[model samples]
Target chain A: SQTIHQWPATLVQPVGSPLSLECTVEGTSNPNLYWYRQAAGRGLQLLFYSVGIGQISSEVPQNLSASRPQDRQFILSSKKLLLSDSGFYLCAWNGGTANTEAFFGQGTRLTVV
Target chain B: AQSVSQHNHHVILSEAASLELGCNYSYGGTVNLFWYVQYPGQHLQLLLKYFSGDPLVKGIKGFEAEFIKSKFSFNLRKPSVQWSDTAEYFCAVSSSGNTPLVFGKGTRLSVIA
Candidate 1:
């Protein structure tokens, strides 16, 4: 079975600090990876998705960026965090095929103070 | 651009009450639909999905959803809900198999025992 792992299950950082969140998938190769943010009481917002290594499509313009360094390793980063950047960040993976269901990681609760 | 709309932001119901959560999407082309559940302090999990073939899709924990293409709607239903069913439900849509999903504002279900 495939599984996704996300690091720093909870994070607390001061404003303007650099941020990095990592996600990795096991038991699958060349999977589609995605980064999503869920604000309190709000639905999820897709931030970035990657089809392959070094290929990323951003869904919205924001302070965050994503990268796929390996076939199953994805990273979400920010040079400087903002107060608005604090939220529940989730990493998901799906089979390379289209319309496939996605599997999610435990998600990181980021708190930017 | 694809967008999803979930009618209720929050719902409170007693155990065994019927559930019907409305979801609508805006897209003219063929689309895929999905329902995800997020338990408290846990990651999001796929409840069900509709790609092709059957319009009514059943999922775990006695949850099901029907995709009505004519109305551009995929509504989740349950004949009887348990207190354990209390969670946040999200509706998502994608234009193609490989496209990034657009999620709704989400409906928070509170099933009181």
Candidate 2:
């Protein structure tokens, strides 16, 4: 079975600090990877999605950016964090084909002080 | 922009009671629908999905949902729910196969034993 792993599970960073969150999927190749953010008691908001290595689509413009360095490895990064960046970040993946059900990893709770 | 709307923000029910959560989407093109469940402190899991064919779809854990094209609604239902059913449920829709999913604000269900 395919599974996604994300870390660190929780993070606290001061404003203006660099941020890096990684997500990796095992048992699947060439999967579609996505990054979503959910503010406290809010819905999931799409941030970025990658169809293949070095290909990324940004849904919203903000302080964060996403990159697909490998077929199964996706990373979300920021040169500087903002207080508004505090939220729950979730990593998800699906089969290469479209309309397939997506699988999610344990989300990372990020709090920017 | 296309969006998904979940009517209830929070729902409380006793064990063995019927469950029905409303989900509506605003899009006219070909779309795929899905319902996801997340237990406390766990990752999101796919409860059910609707792509093509049957309008009524059954998912794991005795959960089901029906797609009504005219109403643009996909409502989740369970004949009898248990205390173990306490979780946050999300409804998501993707208009085009290649696009990212648009999620509803989500419904928090608390089933008391």
User: Which has the greatest DockQ?
Assistant: 1
lDDT of 2 by residue, B77-104 (tens): 9999999999999999986656777789
RMSD to the hidden true structure, all candidates: 1.1, 1.3
DockQ (Cα-based) per candidate? 0.75, 0.68
TM-score of 2: 0.95
lDDT of 2 by residue, A31-67 (tens): 9899999764678999999889999999899999999
The regions of model 1 sitting more than 4 angstroms off are none
Candidate 1 lDDT, A1-113, residue by residue in tens: 88899998999999999999999999999999999999866799889999999999999899999999899999999999999998999999888876888899999999999
> lDDT tens digits, residues B1-113, model 1?
88999999999999999999999999999998999999987778999999899899999999999999899999999999999999999999887767887799899999998
Candidate 2, backbone clash total: 0
Q: Give the Å error, residue A80, model 2.
A: 1.0
Model 2 alpha-carbon drift over 4 Å, by segment: none
What local lDDT score does residue B108 receive in model 2, on the 0 to 100 scale? 96
User: What TM-score do all the candidates reach, one by one?
Assistant: 0.96, 0.95
> Residue A31 error for model 2, in Å?
1.0
TM-score of 1: 0.96
Question: How well does candidate 2 reproduce the true complex, by DockQ?
Answer: 0.68
